[model samples]
Target: MSQHVFLRGMVAIRLFSALAELTGALLMWRFQRLETAVRINGLLGLVGPLVLTTTMALGLAGLAQSRLPAARLVWIGAGVGLILWGTRR
Candidate 1:
């Protein structure tokens, strides 16, 4: 895949994630209820991990295409794993 394509995919997903967060915040504000806000927050939570994983995948793919060393790729993957593990509730 082209580097440009990978970069664009990574950026687009992040932008979408941001938009989702904004929309969720607006929905919470519009509803004006704790229960509704919680529900919205719960749904928003899924969006974050999905976006993160997708963006990382695109970055890794681009790196792989560039012939990055296998060890470095493993380290990168491990770093992402640690981030997800550390953030989990």
Candidate 2:
């Protein structure tokens, strides 16, 4: 895919993720119930990682066509892994 496509995809996913979070917060506030808030938060938590992985994947795909070395790519992948691992419960 072209770099423009990759960039657009990455930006779009992040925007969607942001919208989801804002909507989740609004819903939690509107409901004004602990159970409903918790459920919304739980679903938002899933969106976080999915968005992260998708944006990173698009970035990596774009980088794959660039001059960056394979070893650097490995390091980047490891960094992303560490991020996911560190954030896990």
TM-score of each: 0.95, 0.94
Alpha-carbon lDDT of model 1: 0.94
lDDT of 1 by residue, 21-69 (tens): 9999999999999999999999999888888888999999999999999
Per-residue lDDT tens digits of candidate 2, residues 1-89? Answer: 57889899999999999999999999999999999999999999988999999999989888987767999888998999999999999
lDDT of 2 at 45: 93
- Supply candidate 1's per-residue lDDT for 25: 98
Query: After superposition on all CA atoms, what RMSD does each candidate show versus the true structure?
Result: 0.8, 0.9
Q: Tell me the deviation in Å of residue 6 in model 1.
A: 0.3
Candidate 1 C-alpha RMSD relative to the actual structure: 0.8
